[model samples]
Every structure is written in C-alpha cells, then in structure tokens.
Target: MEETKIFLITYFAALLGVVPPGLVNMSVAKTCVKRGKKNGIYMAFGASFIVLLQAALAIMLARYIFDNTYINNVLLRAGLVIFLIMMFYFLLMAQRKRKEVEVTPTSGFRSILKGMMIGVLNIFPIPFFVALAAALNVHGDIEYHLLNNTAFVLAASLGTFTTLYLYALFFAKIEAEGTYFARYSNYFMAALMLILVVITFIRIFSQ
Candidate 1:
C-alpha cells in the first residue's frame, strides 16, 4: 500500500509538472509541427529516458540535497543562468525567417537525440523531484527502499512521456485551429523561459 501510494503520488506530481506548456513539451509540439508525430514520439521517449535517471538521482539524494543549503542555492543560481540562456535562444529562434524555420526530415535517432539534448538542458526537474522526495520523506510517506524508489522513478518517467506524447499528438490540430500559437510558439517559449528566469532570480536573492 505504501509503495502504491508513493507511485501514485510521484506519478501525478510528475504528470502535472509537465502538463504546463514548457520547454520539453513545447519542443515536442514544435517537432510535431515541423516534422511528424512519429519523430515527436521518438523525442518524447528520449526526454523520458533522461527523466528516469533524474528521478532516481533525486530520490537518492533527496535528504542530502534538502540538508545542504549551499548546494541548493548554487543550483538555483545555475538554473537562473540556464533559464536566461534558453530565453535568449528562443527569442532568437522567434526572429528567424519562415524559410529558415521550414520543416526538415530527420531520422528517429536524430529526433531522440534532440529530445535528450533538450531534456538535459532543462535542469529544473532535478530540483523539483528532489524537493518532492524530501517532502515525502519528512511526511513519512515515502521509503527509500529499492522497490519503492524504482516505482517512483518509473512513474516519473512514464508520466512525463504521457504528457509529451499528448502534446505531440494534438499539436497539429491545435496549430490548425490557432495559427497564432503555431506562428509564435517560439515566442511563447521565450516568454515562459523569461518567467522562469524571473522566478529563479527572486528565489536566489530571497534565500
């Protein structure tokens, strides 16, 4: 029962986390618009693969991360820098000519690689899962046993994949209905990244 609870909690938390239109899912949606659903799915798989490892690491290091204020502050600072970089990257992409944004065919491997690269670039998940794990531990709702942790990791990965897959699946229809969203997806991403950057900056200084 405890293991089941942990799995459910972690799964829903992860699912909700990715439901927001953010970097990985936005990238997946863009790929679907530019390439195809198959490539988008491949990318989702690649991103989820990284989530598996990240979830595991977070759970394992939960206590240590929670206890170390310096490490936490450093991570926040690093995340701020990363968010700023991503914000600029998306802003630049938004400025490119339509011809430059034309769809290009790519292999599944390449799609997967792109997904993994984006996943790596997104560092927020590590701290998020770490905090979740620490909270669960403090509440006596989680056990660090192998089976429980395995379930937690698997759930996190699956939840992320599910959200990404949905984004890949419906993006085309969304694009057809909302031309603005399609045309300004990069700008939307840049805006979201800027928001993240602001939030991270506040957190760093407030701490």
Candidate 2:
C-alpha cells in the first residue's frame, strides 16, 4: 500500500507538472499537427526515456541531501522561499501571452532522436523531482529505497509519456484552445505553489 501510494504520488506529480503547454508537449502537439500522430508518439517515447534518467538522477540527489540532516533542514527552509518565488513566477506567466509553437518536420526514427534532443535541452525535471522528493520525504510519503525509487522513476516517465500522448492525440483541440488552457494551467500551478509554500513553511517550523 505504501509503495502504491508513492507510485501514485510521483505519477500524478509528473502528469500534472507537464499539463501546462511547454516545450516538450507543445512540440509533440506541433509534431502531430505537422507530421503525424505516429511521429508524435515516437517523440513522446523518446522524451519519456530521458525522463527515466532524469528522475533517477533527481532521486539520487535527493537521497544525498536526505542523508545530511543539516542540509535537509536547510533545504526545507529554502524550499519555502523557492515555493513562494514559484508562486509569483507562475502567476506572472499566467498574465503573459503564450507564443505559438513552431515545429520542424521530421519522420521515422529521426523523430525519436529529435525528441531526445529536445528532452535533453529541457532542464527543469531534475530540480522539480528533487524538490518533490524532498517534500514527500518530509511528509513520510516516500522512502528512498530501491523499490520505491524505481517506482517513482518509472511512474514519472510514464506520466510524462501519457501527457505528451494526450497532447498528440488532441492536437487540434489543443491548438484551438491552448492559450486559455495555458493561462488557467499557470494559475493552477501558482495556486499549487502557494500550497507548497504553506506546507514547506509548516514543515520547517515544526522541525
């Protein structure tokens, strides 16, 4: 049951984390529009493959931080500040205009390589997962063991793929309604960050 909970938490985190129109998913959608769903799916697979590595690296970093009591405590306090910053950043993003995604055409296995390249360029996942791991650790929701860590990485990768697949599957609708979706998604992210801020603050004070 605990393992399942860890899996679900990490899965949903990755899923919702990618819901906002971003480089990878937006590229997937654009690929679907310009090339085809097949290519887009291929790209998602490639990106998800990289997510596996990124998640693993993040968990490893989180484990290192967790091993040091002083650092962990400091990070929790720092997390509170970071969460507050993220809240305002997302709120600002919500008010900004979203730009159209431009995709270059690719086909076959090359699409996968293209996706891999794009995934490599996206540097947000590692820190995001690290912070999430820290927060979950504080809540006793995650254990840094082999089984739990594996589940977390696998779930995160699968979650990313699922979101990208959905973007590919619904490219037309997404293209039509993307601005509104992104705006609201940013607002939602801002709200979520605020909640994290509160949680981090309480965790820090309680320690």
- List TM-score per model, in order: 0.91, 0.63
Residue 35, candidate 1: Cα error in Å is 1.1
| Model 1, runs deviating above 4 Å | 100-103, 175-179
Scanning candidate 2 in windows of ten residues, the lowest lDDT window is 174-183
Q: Write model 2 residue lDDT over 100-180, tens digit each, in one string.
A: 533345666988988887687565687678878888788665568899889999999999998998888897455445545
Top-lDDT candidate index: 1
Clashes by residue pair, model 2: none
Off by over 4 Å in 2: 63-106, 139-142, 172-207
